[model samples]
Target: MHIQSCGTAIDVNFKDVGSDRDELLQATKKILQKQLVGQSYRLIILQHILPDTVTFLRMARNAGINVAKVFAKPNSIHKPSLETLVDEGFAVSCLDYGEMEGTEVLDKAILQEHALAVQYQEQLVCVDVGGYFCEPLRRLSPKKLPNFKGVVEVTTFGHNRYSAKVKYLAHPVISLAKSPLKNAEALIVGESATLATDLILRENGYLFVGSKVGVLGFGAIGHSTAKALRSKGHLVTVFDTDPIKRVAAKLEGFGVSSSKQDLLGNCDFVFSATATRAVEVADLKHFQNGLVLVSVGSKANEFDIDGLVDAAETAAIDSDGISCLTYAGGTKLKVLRMGKAVNFHVQSCPDEVMDLVFAETVACMATLSTDLPKSVLSELSDESRKEIAAKWLQRGTYERN
Candidate 1:
């Protein structure tokens, strides 16, 4: 089969590596690979280097897909897995979150990908984590970058970014951020974040039990985290800018804060799951003494770390992995994982849970390889998700039996 785009056609001849139903990732790979057997495309993925991600990449390669480049987030790169990718002959690059802004890193990557596409005459498909490719790709002329096919965005944050640029997009985007598969993963992520926070606090000689905890967002992760914390004996209050989410929290029996200030003032520890800058530098004044800030999302943008550092009289990391920022007025704020995702500091999502997301991502890639509407946003069909879920269930049952 030949998938034609931009006056170029690539022949796809993927042979079915028979189903390995006992292993989840392998089983998922087999099921999803059926969609790509008659399609071909090169992939450039921007993702964290977690164990599941490493497994996903190997699965993609085994399915006869050419993984051109993988841009690993610096904050979430697992060293051993990264070395494995290097040794396996996968072209890998790590993004520097400190020296370069997220979009800047994405822009540079897109440019390099454009060059590769032009030179190799292969259609390019970008798998984005944080919507980093949306704006930069929107600005590019289609005539100059013809080999670019589309993107598969996998985060709610990234989906929002692409949604904003939907009208101006120059290529198709398959969003799995808000898909049911991702929603399932978010539940596990939320539970993992809560556990990691507790473990980190204990390691730092702080008891989170009986503490007043506040969740800064009432999204899926926030809601799950709040419930998990409350179950573990923490007083959990929830806050959100969205009135609907605030109402949802209230209806769900969580103590809803009237304002961010109220939540900040009342809670001993605040978990920012807003995916954006939930707490800014100016909000530091409302911070009470000995308040700990935890970022539940992947990026450091959850809390303004640079602003906090600049405003602090002294910033230092103790023997524990926590960073303490002492303000001039004597308020000390402790940050876990230096404002990166705490769940990542521990194990990310469990391997089985993340396999669902990875499988969905691969399915999205297969969908992108087909001829689709251009310069618009799309999603994996319900039929596709159901198919993946069915395979997952089959694998799980087989493992148990």
Candidate 2:
């Protein structure tokens, strides 16, 4: 196979190297090497600090890409992976998701990239999660730094951010979040999150089966989680701000709540998968006693933990480190995993499942070198994603057979 990008022609090949995790990653690396060859952009990657991410970064470097800087969400930083990244000479930083309502951490990274661009005379590219780089990239002063090539946004939340700023951007923005390939990954992530919640509840001496579960948001993750919970013999109710989603849930045979208050008032447990502040401090009053709140999204902002802490008359931590917030009149709610994504409390997904998205992400980097429409949010071509999927299916089927 041959792919031409950045005015350079490169030969590409995909061969079965076995179907194990390492083998698949090696194959992915070979594909990236051919696609990204002859590119000289300084890449800034923002993703979870995981073993798989370590493999991806190492492969990018091996494929002749300059990985200038790496950043991770504060809660998603895995110690072993952090150590590995640092040991391998990758400049890394953890972004603060604190009380401040600004993009200071991301701003720092942007400044660093600007400096590197001046020093190295290379165009800049960013791979962002959750739209952290959206504003920073848009805010770039062309006079000071005109070498920004583009960005690849990986999450729906981030894609939303980029879309809002599309009119103001000066560089191309490629979104994988809206791709059909990512919808497949979202379903697997949803299942993993539900299983993780079940395991945590069981570990804490609670029976998940008997509890009435509610899912906030009817997006892909939320929809899949509701189905997974129902399959586990739990009655599932869902609430979404969108009427279409509510109707879809009702049609799917799941109870639909008309309002957030009704859902919180009724369910024994709730999964906040909206990727926004689904539960606020004012809404805290609606929570029934003994309600367990589980966050399934990437960030802790799914529920306003700070607001809950301030509103609580008293807070207590159990032996398992679960925090119980007690409001007036004896209403208590327990937050699991300290309001972070519970699925990542261990691993987010099996390596094989994550490999599909990771492969697509690497392939998308090659698009940065191509002439894409500037200042707009676009998806990688269907043909490109199909090609990656076909390769994945071939290796997976071969392994299984």
Candidate 3:
């Protein structure tokens, strides 16, 4: 409770008046300062935003990362989308990774842990609403690696600890209980919850109820995406590497499959969220034309975009005199952003549902703690507004040194 030099206090109030989002954000700041050992922590986080990184930072703190005294750069990972926050001097000041090597505060072990975790699993899905792994090595505490041992999974029934990172997922709940027809038509498959949900919604609009759909990867987001598809009257087909999970989906009234070619060739929509880098890349040749290929993996290597780029017309948006898309036919694809990245919470204008979920999740995870210094979860409630605010500002004060 008495974390020192960790900046501000961190505590979220999901229910109350006069208690706003600033309290949540502050909570996050304090925890990160404590866990990552700011004085020596050197890490570089690259992202459009820092919410997910922030979330994981909080989770690390809960696992025992001493954020305040040990890790350096209290605000390195706290690069706020808000121009005001950036201007207010809360952003992580940039440093030369070339210069800050061989220091005791800087831990080569940090990268070693991530490398080990990545090596531990065939595939790893690193999720962050706020920070990146690099920040720990480059700016925070270089003296140590993240406290991987503190990371654990605690459900309502029990708890389980994992050596790998992805095992500490974001969440696992979805609502597909809209109507009886939702159950009648069910099929689920996609690489990520966002993409699976998007494609399944489209599939339900086109396919009739009771249509068998196959879902690959039933992780936290995957399950929700599949459930949403199931609600729209398409049958969800479950296929995954996890035995317990694969069987669970089967028990939940879904057909399970093991072969990628066999499953995609047959299902109306092959939504995949398997949490791997190249999910269906090499094996994508098996998918037939008009197969409605879509990817939602956080890392865009899930599908062979190079192959699909020639098959469709793309939409164009000129950014600073740069053409962002290419129009082919009716398929609104981005030749520039070929990867079908859809923010489920912010799919449309003025939508922050995902951001809210992201902030809440991080807040809860940060309170938990880690061995290495880690940050606490703070509410970035106004991330959308902050994003817009940043649009008007030029590049951050950081000019490569």
Candidate 4:
């Protein structure tokens, strides 16, 4: 199969299970040699890269289609195969934390800024996909905003979660980044840096080596959190109702707990990144004494904040963004960011990481540069995805490895 768009072309050759591995590489090489775009391309492998996959990547690089990046989780790349790819001159920019984008919020310090009303008389307000627009929009309104004429919604994915809350604003709304790719963009850019940065900040300053960490969910955010914690030498245990996710975690060599109680009871630091209500008042009873509860997900209710406030004998925010609380049971806990995303609250995300995500969102917005779409959501052309990738690469946030 072949696909061409955005100044690059992709040619794919599928190999069935038990198919001749040598044959597959040769077939892929022939396709690669036929197409020369004068620029390197990434080989995105969703699953583990077997010997056959490495051979294909190596051959493609020889054909001038250098593997400038490897678009897969770090775990998916077999170490020996990765060694070969690196030895064969592949750049291999793994699209894990390195390609993540959500940390832009911390670099921009959007949280520290007092909510400013939209001052545009008739200008466009583009809420790019960086999860940085919500707090800013809270201060915007027709009455409060100075010279605010209308809003040009550059992205639609934010509507369900953000724009809906600000519907009282009279500005005309124009949703543009509605493409299915936008959702993919969100997945790539939203949680990636947030999880990495949060873990980095906490581990560097607070979480000592070999600390016991419990992750509340096993979804994208939770998975990334667990991976980051594990990388920092923490004994990470994951809690999720989804047996498949639990099994997947176990397969990856991480500890998995079937019950939330098990995770909360055993770990010293518990992070809630489930993107939903994972902990309630009753569950709080299971929390180990002096457990550090940090909410890394953006959404509220992940910790039953109201319940935490009600159950705590004393709750107060510290200068470092930690919420110190004493429960009625006398279990003292330090909740990061008032149970909000810790990175945003502390504004501790590294600047380079934020640049990558901001670059991608800007590139995604540029795809809608032409005539405005009347549709609620639109499709992202292959060109746009390629552009996002290029812009992200151009940002130079993550080095080639």
Instruction: Please give each candidate's TM-score.
Output: 0.88, 0.88, 0.45, 0.49
Model 2 TM-score is 0.88
lDDT of 4 by residue, 55-85 (tens): 5555544655323334333222334444555
Q: After superposing candidate 1, which stretches have Cα over 4 Å from the reference? A: 1-22, 98-121, 318-320, 371-375, 396-401
Candidate 1 per-residue C-alpha lDDT over 345-371 given as tens digits, one digit per residue, 9 for 90 to 100? 566576677777888887877776665
Pick out the ten consecutive residues of candidate 1 with the lowest summed lDDT: 1-10
Candidate 3's C-alpha runs over 4 A off are: 1-20, 23-84, 92-212, 307-337, 344-401
Question: What is every candidate's alpha-carbon RMSD to the true fold?
Answer: 7.7, 7.9, 15.1, 16.4
Question: What is the Cα-based lDDT of residue 334 in candidate 2?
Answer: 93
lDDT of 3 by residue, 275-330 (tens): 45434344444554334433443333345565555443552432111122232434
358: Cα error in model 1, Å = 1.5
Candidate with best lDDT = 1
Query: Number of clashes in every candidate structure?
Result: 0, 1, 126, 2
Ranking of predictions according to lDDT: 1, 2, 4, 3
In candidate 2, list every pair of residues with a backbone clash.
131-158
lDDT of each: 0.76, 0.74, 0.36, 0.49
Q: Is candidate 3 or candidate 4 better by lDDT?
A: 4
